[model samples]
Target: MPIEWIDCKPISLVWFSWREPLLYVLFTPWLLSLFAGLLITALTVVLSIRLSWLNRSLIVISAVLSVNIIYSPLATQWLSVWLSSQLPQTFERAEDAPRPVAVLLGRGAKIGRATSRKAAQLLNDHKVEAVYVSGDRLSTAQRVVKLGAPAERVAGDSCARTTWQNATRTNAWLQRNHPEAPVLLITDPWQLPRAAHAFAGQGLKVMPMAISPQLNSRTRNRLALRETAGTLLYRLQGRM
Candidate 1:
């Protein structure tokens, strides 16, 4: 029987969805840590006015611990993509990923976020003919990938409404460039189903390259709610 999926739906939708870094950049986990540090710094100032040196010393120690624990790891994660490669096996599809033209979809069209390292290895080995990043040509890196097409075929793109937008824009690009190429759409597991729907709807043959890590935290949880609401708002704005 198909599982009812009622309980799993919201959690899967939130935890697995790729949050494109478009709005409220501060709400990002790293920036929120900065906000936490500032909060503690303010607290330290308030306490220093009342406490003696010995007691104030305790405040300093506590402040550093709070910020380090709450924020340092996030900063490390936001910065060190290398460290992430050391963590336990997260997503498994890429382990034996087929050499379909990697329809690498994400907010960052890099060789890392969606396992560009692995993708690059595959491309170098003639596994994937090209690394097609689907999104607006937001940076020079994206454009550079395209200038060397066939050998690279970067194909930096844009005009996406959501994960769904990534599908539509990529299809148009594919039709213009490699229409016969099969797609190995890469995205967070949570988003793959939704994105797959849009791609299949567009009459494209696709295989999922689910490569995102599971996000578990209060902030990520809240972001899920925010995304759901934001999605509704976009629908209202006639943007979706």
Candidate 2:
């Protein structure tokens, strides 16, 4: 069952542009750790001329371990599972239920296409009333349109640059037109948790729909690390 109520604490939107950059710098655990390890390794190499061999070895070992943990598949798998654990293990909506409005969270070309494809499928199946592409609006909307969705049936926001913006901006429109309609929040599986939480925070009834992309281990781990950081950041900001 979809979580119907979650109180998202109000946050100041002042200086909102800084949120995304700061999130990666301050809240991204693996990224910050990577930078720290690289810096330590560089400094150790430079100071090895003066430091004792034992101390130098210890620094190098610590740096390597810190960097290696993020690349480890087991570590990534654990984090991925824990992150998505909050999402429903199973979901079912009655066929007679009101049709949901599809909301595709903006992303890169590959994910945009995948998400758009899903939205088109829902539209084609008459499962959704309409499709709204948040964030990268033009690109995503174009993809959905190209996939055969009627131009009039699809709409979007080109201004949303972050997940928070995606929810708030989309809600700005939804609250007036589809206030009572259930939202089908669409995005990559790894990002669905945060995306769902963000949309729900806006007081929209959200049903998560994740589209899995074909990704290599390296790419998948990279995305997982980023999402783990993003989830932490949103929690800190009281957005999730």
Candidate 3:
């Protein structure tokens, strides 16, 4: 089952299906901010016109907010790049160290194609001995297999719905299976810090390998904003 909070259905369904533009409006940060800014600006204009005593300050505030909303995508991109630079792209395990497992966190019910490709590449490059995906195990395993990975080399944990669950459950699996192996935690750059924290908290040694998406400005901004919010939420819950 999907984690209630991480799953988009509750919010996306209210507007439209996951594939619809309305879902973007509801979940995408830049678009949602733009929509809100426009609405506020329109309201300010109507009030200013209707009341002679309406303060010019309100108009100025609306304009500034609108500009910020429009520019959010660029801001998010900058943040992601900065965060990516602060983390390592590759993990080097000592020759004597046990072979590490590549743990790829799923985006939702599906392990996205980009992540699947990255996992396959890691296996091919000999960066990891095996790949363990968290989220929808069956689907994630299927995706890896479709990407040409041997079925035996890929493992899955379907019960993990949140980052904490991902870490704890995977850690348990590792302990039972490959106790001394370090983990190559995989996810987007923006999500790496929290994921690393969660895994480390579970007493697992982690080496983060981020998959930075090549998204357009608007999409990047949306992802950044979503990641920002997720980070904050995790912090509040004392998970990161």
Candidate 4:
């Protein structure tokens, strides 16, 4: 049920591997941008050969596109910082109050590891009472347990294949188990906003916790462009 092919036996296990989706999400935008630039440049060259005046117009368009592509890294960094700023870094923890639960959005091993570590630390610090992991639930739960989280305090749901599903399933679980509890949502920096919106839409009080620290310029741009495309696609599908 973890996004694997049902009939194919040989490569079905590949679904458990996290690299495929990560690579797709991280590089798809850059690949599309490169393809578009090449196509546009070829078109511009063909147009300029016949109409000299059109050359200026095409050049301007290309220039603008190039600038946007080049500026993606900074834009992504700014967006990440801005999104992170929207959530509180510190929350009041009182002895008599119910402890907040940490919700880890599953994507890959690295993200799961980071979230697990954070969850463990928060547990140690008495910041959260329990940890709920979404995506490939069995594996994620195992990883969190391996990272030192108590098995009894960790819960997981494998049915969530997307951010929306993650939110909805987790919301349902919370409603049944810990209604009105504050949730500390954890995910990649680029996905913070969409994930937060999805969780909030379910009437859950979500406090986003982005795991990644500062990314390099090039990586930031690439991630930013990819996130932008992803956001637009989700919007078109009415997912976000």
Pick by TM-score: which candidate is best? 2
Against the true structure, candidate 3 reaches a TM-score of: 0.69
Candidate 4: lDDT over CA atoms? 0.68
Q: Write the per-residue lDDT of candidate 2 for residues 72-126, one digit (tens) a residue.
A: 7887798789778756432345777777889987678888888899899889887
Estimate the TM-score of every prediction. 0.46, 0.77, 0.69, 0.69
Model 2 clashes, total count: 0
Cα lDDT for residue 6, candidate 1: 11
Candidate 3's residue-wise lDDT over 81-167, tens digit each?
A: 655653433346798898788888867432266777888887878777778887644666667667767777788766666677788
Model 2 residue runs over 4 Å out of place are 1-56, 88-96
**lDDT (10s digit) by residue, model 1, range 116-233:** 4455556667767566666433443233343333434555454444566667777877787678766766655434555565676677777766565545554443433344445455
Our model 1 lands, by Cα RMSD against the true structure, at 13.1
**Worst-scoring 10-residue span by lDDT in model 2:** 1-10
lDDT of 4 by residue, 83-128 (tens): 5554433344556867788998766666667777888788767788
Where in model 4 is the C-alpha error above 4 Å? 1-50, 53-72, 82-96, 213-222, 233-240
lDDT of 2 at 128: 90
Sequence-dependent TM-score of model 2: 0.77
Each model's Cα RMSD: 13.1, 7.3, 6.9, 6.6
lDDT of each: 0.52, 0.76, 0.68, 0.68
**Candidate number with the higher lDDT (1 or 3):** 3
